[model samples]
Target: MGLGLFRMFNCFSSKPREIPIILGSETPPRPKQRQRKEELGGGGESKIGGILGRPYVDINTMYEMKKELGRGQSGVTYLCIERSTGREYACKTIARGKLVRKEEIEDVRREIMILQHLSGQPNIVEFRGAYEDRQNVHVVMELCSGGELFDRIIDKGTYSEREAARLMRQIVTVVHVCHFMGVIHRDLKPENFLLASKGSLAPLKATDFGVSVFIEQESQSHMNPIHRRRRQTEANKACQHTVQQNQRRPRRKALTDINELYRLERELGRGQFGVTYLCTEKATGRQYACKSIARRKVTRKNEMDDVKREIMILQHLTGQPNIVEFKGAYEDRQHVHLVMELCRGGELFDRIIARGSYSEREAASICRQIVNVVHVCHFMGVMHRDLKPENFLLVSRDHNAPLKATDFGLSVFIEEDKVYKEIVGSAYYVAPEVLKRNYGKEIDVWSAGVILYILLSGVPPFWGETEKQIFDAILEGKLDLESAPWPSISAAAKDLIRKMLAYEPKKRITASAALEHPWMKEGGEASDKPIDNAVLSRMKQFRAMNKMKKLALKVIAQNLSEEEIKGLKQMFNNMDTDRSGTITFEELKSGLSRLGSKLSETEIRQLMDAADVDKNGTIDYYEFITATMHRHKLEKEENLYKAFQYFDKDSSGYITRDELRHALTEYQMGDEATIDEVIDDVDTDKDGKINYEEFVAMMRKGTLDNEGVIGKERTR
Candidate 1:
């Protein structure tokens, strides 16, 4: 045995007296020539020392045990505070009664030995000491407050490929280091890996070694108390046999013509580079979705790589519980046809919208499936950078149909130690770290978190009028957990959301950890209580309302009493900042931040543009007041009549197309196309003109306004 082997068995016998373990500087005495055989071969009982057979030492005399932190299958972990230094640590108490078999007792000794051997290494939790008494065995170690890997996985949002790969790299490092140090960790999983602290970029620490063993012990059957040598050999042989069988199996040749196997039907959907069509297999009549990528559209080399990578990833991820099954891939002169499972249940949001009265439980169920996709993808060594509601589909029209993830166009293989900088993903679902260009797989969790927020509240947590505004909101806006529906939402749900949406990638919850969250877990803390109807209204459409409704709201805002508009006026004055009687771009940004606003700078600019009725670059008091007025205020009968009068210039009880055009042109809010769209959206009776009732209904009811409505009033 070398110096490393000596360091592993430094513990002394408990026969005489217990010796203190000095972590940093302890060096065992060198073995004499005569005693070297006994130490290296390890045949006698003294060879193992007092690993579990230690004389009773009262652990309570040194450490004060507090509340129970967690309970596992083997032991209960408590928050242990050292009496002398008042330093906190975790104490796992394993009852002596549980060690019924001799093998169990020996395994415990090996675990303690391995932990001591691997101590002082980065990413492995620091072991303080192990103590034994008559009733139980106590193991003390570093307190990891950042929570479990599985906890954050289901708890939070989506992740980018780079972020997921970063997390995976950390996990792989722990395994690599363990193997290098002559120990094999048999129980390495997400739950075993924990963050050292609660900080975003906290180091991941391997906290368990119960089933770990030294390589020498595994190789030598006589030295191994469990006699695992034969078992290990059999396992290796079985793996090799499986590999040989797979190699001997006949492989299918690539199909050049998809038309020969399947008959293409109606087009299901179309994208920028490809078209998805419903196809029927000629032999079996099984329906599948065939996505044909036009070769011409993939002009760039990177774009072509993206297409090929997507096909490969889909094939690689086939048979996953939450991923769509890839049927086959075909190539022709014109296009590349990739076939997969056809999900008849449609998109995730579509099901939610159709459900009518949604609840936290249902949202949790959906989010669990979404995060599972992230977990599965990351585990398979693929990073799905683009994760949004549209990418998910239900397997069938059944109410309890299983959800599946589709589309891998932006996905990539997780390369070790690689720093990914390319910005990818939908604007609303992208993580902040992706924007910073140093992200990892955690970006998927962040995106999933955004989807959760939308699922719970019926709209995205970060709302904006444009892509730039959405990115700004992602970078700067605070997550809103106090708005309308949020007050009624469960605390557990909000806590998970906070962990998922953590600003730092290192701090953000992993997909496996998120899945273990209380709210995200199956039949866990998520409530069955119906969410507010307002959330459903907002989710249906987040864009600007019709131009007519906006003009009406503004008219109503102008007529408000002094008391009603007092707060609005003060807010406008405060935003003006320099007492300039108008709010400039810089002033508006600063003011919003001061007011605890979640709006980004770009969103503020959109608000400023919407409020500035005179088309000025800044927002004046009147414009600000009008733009900030709540929708309920526009519902008052007097206010509605006044606004209708403003548009119904002729007082003929109906506003004709000319009147609408004139009002819109006077405000410079629309042209021919906008006027037509507004009429097309708000004109319920199809009279091509608006009546008083119609105007009031437009003001009161929720409308999917696609054009020219002012900001804040339409979105918030």
Candidate 2:
């Protein structure tokens, strides 16, 4: 439905249990005699051997159950520690005995299929492996320790239109990729989106597509609701049929995953990456592209690691067509052989230039194809840091041929809260932030804007006799909308360009937002109407104010005295039924009733909706503090001091370094050294401990510098 421009690799994908090394070829296994069908998933009294590629082992031998991660109507997810490796994974235990309906079984199968297919995708939370017990099915997956996305947005001082655009772009791109894979995510609300980890600009991930479809069974018009409904019914029926049809399984020897069946045909291309050769499978005589990279040619360890990572990324994206399909990989003493789908047609620009005098409609059409590939890449958490036209290839010489993105040599998987400072990308398309040594995926959007501008006008947006002048113009961001043909360009098109070219990285429109612009919707056609001037003015004002308000909230939240937040946390814990450290609405109701106050379900929902800043369905300490601070009744300063005395343990009205250290670390405030530093800064008498008067003075921080209270000031 939209076009995508990249900000970076967009390659940050997820976990796997036994990630098969794609290289080092193995001989094809001899065919084994097929066994007679038995029962569901080879079921005969549920004697487990193996179903998927993984071997069945004692589940208890592998993982040590830590604590509950989450609970739903059908299952409970535990934070498990792998006994031998000490690696953490999420293990979902779904009680089979609790399920009665055939639909429920089908649901389990559906979830398994979705996780299996989308396992290694970046934006989607990963599926490691699954095991079956006597009474339940246990599915293991990557445990995302990062908090939810909307929660960060609420608490970040650096929030802006650009920030919102970046996050939404991730969401939309993920949805876009899911659609391409024939999986329609039925539930995509804020609750389903999480940051891969904490801090700012973490990789946003999609999870819990509970009502999602793995594959569509019928074609229908997306614009028509009736046809869509009919398609839905067909898809559901197909899913049920698939589950019933696979009820019985036949045993057979597992074949080796190898590309030894293929024979080299001819050399296609050669570059710094590797030598590409045309190859064909001997059994089926199907064509393929094989990349042979000599190990000796790679001088650095990191470069060789990059080569290995590329193969892994390719294997993970095996079935997606937008990405070049990975067939297999093999390793010899001298080189690595990576096989893939061959694109006969050349670069996208090669066709665009050859066609000549193309209309705006054609430009939009071509741009849409590029967007689709980029959308998938971003959703997979891969940033194609380099996104010029040369990186994309047409499937064939045909005019209507689709394009696929390639050359992931520059791609890298980003983690949640990580910011890349590398200077990468072609000179013309690089974003301003990149030059400053601080940037994110937004670099791709800037590059895409350059592409779109050139596609529309057949000339570069900013140009000069030398590279320096060109870069200067880019940094200045002055576009000549009135220059020659631009005067005749559609206002919607011009408006989009202006938004994209905004000087401030914090204000630039995201690729997703750009796709939704009227110019994009019109397919490059001129719009008689422009965005309402007053509305536009109001939008500008709102964007500015929204940025400030979010930043202010973040500062206030961060600067809040730990004592104040601690009080709210106690109240939060009282309502936390499972002692999970977060309180859901049901728990809140029960907890509040126990405390002699009863609230209706509607009222409870309303409060949770307001207080659950992260939209993670539960309220943590931060959210609890944020919510309770605005309550009508306030805790007296004397009460806060008394609470401090309680932590003192000796009723001495003072806290030793060890006592304060234990308190702060337990509350997730800071480390031991940080707690010591904070106490020393507020000790007032050069003592090794913090007294009540000094603590109270530190809490009332309006009179002192930041060092007096928290040792350092928080800033965006």
Candidate 3:
């Protein structure tokens, strides 16, 4: 069987003695394999190894545990088959000896609660069921025969660029969903990510919420000051132990702490928050970094506040697509710990350092995702006061998901109309306003713009030997856009960066607005320009529709006199065909025909084209009235010109069509039919020509109807 087929079997066999070795399966030979797997397990075996030996879990009876699958710090995960359903499952069991403290039990329970709440999330690992027996708490999850992402990375070395982008996109989407719902996965790393298959398209799942917390909304009750202090006390101890352990341990070997049994792997890295270990989940034989905070580090008041605030911020920012997720937070006597989603692809900063720099397109793609994340935070009234390259970590090479934004140490909460006074963040990317201690979330935008500038140019816009010089350079707000390296940057990108790094906070473009910027447009294209004609037409249509609707309502409300009502009804009747009280397009066309203005067979199309803003064909009463008024305006203008022409009897200036026709009929020059035909023919250029030139000529004394007198006189 494949490695995936053997994953569940490893969970049920935790003890070093009890581990079932499969001859034909892909199990590694004892010593050589242990060295390779031990790094992921960190330095403790107590958490993973003892889980299988728990007396409460009847692994033999409940599940026919097969080959060992993987391990972790706290439990062993096995590939087991349910006899009744014959369904496959990955079962995790906590060993007895490893359960040294009450907090460990609480951590397990907390994970169960979190998983229950997150049951509907498809991207999250599916929780099957949990059982409590005499010896252990047995938690079962879906068997993703795909195995750990860490191993895949190892097998493949490094992923292709497309693969990395695809993975980042998927992971970011998952993180976004979690943030929307107010859940934060504080610990995000590679081993926490499990692949559902070995294929490139395999689904990635974020698991291990051993230290996650759900902050109740609208309540400060859960904010335990003393509890946090105590947690910090524990974290300090954990930090001291970790530092001491590191000093004594040799390179490439596992170290063990007396407090915990899990073998610690080499240190991945250290941060102000805590140290991360590449340890294995011994029970399941899975590798994961168990990030532990030493009790010595978090003892300060400010440090504890940072911890709590980070949790709060993560909880509030539940749906952001790019932020890293917090799996869970817990505490041992020596440490306050957080379990997280592990990204095997490593830090973005590291990648950039190794590769030197990314191309403009690659940089833009990364920046766009970051902008999206910042947008989410700003919309929710939160600020990630510290946004730097170090905080951006890649999940995979497919770029399926965005690089996860980690390290919320310096973040803050800002309510509406509130401004923050904290002077925090790395000196390199810090905005000028932040240095002056007058900054808000827009500072983050400025930092982001600076980062984008760096990504594209391989250097930041403002740099100095010291913090002060950097601040001065930022305040100067000068960019050498015309300089050698800078000149190559696209105008759109330069424009975006300038807007983002605007010196004045008020003038700085907001995150949502920045997303609409030309640089961020899909495929790096510019946004669509405005259509002037559409705008003007839409405005006129809106005003006319509103006015007509008001008038129609007033007429129906019995507020008008009967005479006025009759006049309004007449107007309505003129447009309403079939007398159905509603004006249909057919009725309107017929009415126009009576006035010598006939509509085309495509009249419906014309009406729709003129009246429908959203392009739905059917015109309501309001739309009908508005269209009619517009057409009426045109006709009224024509009539006024014709009347003026008729008054000018000489026809040198103007004459109405009526006067010319009358003159022709009276003189017997032409009868009604002939006069009508002549007038119609004379009205050239259409519009019932009654212009001054035509009117004066027609009215000149030349002919009379009775053959007796010829005069320019008005006849009744």
Instruction: Give all TM-scores, in the order shown.
Output: 0.46, 0.40, 0.40
Point out the worst 10-residue segment of candidate 2 by lDDT. Answer: 707-716
Cα deviation of 69, candidate 3, in Å:
34
Better of 2 and 3 by TM-score: 2
Instruction: Estimate, for each residue in 384-430, the C-alpha lDDT of model 2 and write its tens digit.
Output: 67666656778788878877776665555433344566555555566
CA lDDT, candidate 2, residue 548: 18
Question: What Cα-based lDDT does every candidate model obtain?
Answer: 0.66, 0.55, 0.50
Candidate number with the higher lDDT (2 or 3):
2
| Full ranking by TM-score | 1, 2, 3
Candidate 3, residue 642: how far the Cα is off, in Å: 99
> Runs in model 1 with CA error above 4 Å?
1-255, 543-716
Question: Per-residue alpha-carbon lDDT of model 3 for 466-550, expressed as tens digits?
Answer: 3345657777878756764555556787888889888888898888788877678667653233222322222222112222222
lDDT of 1: 0.66
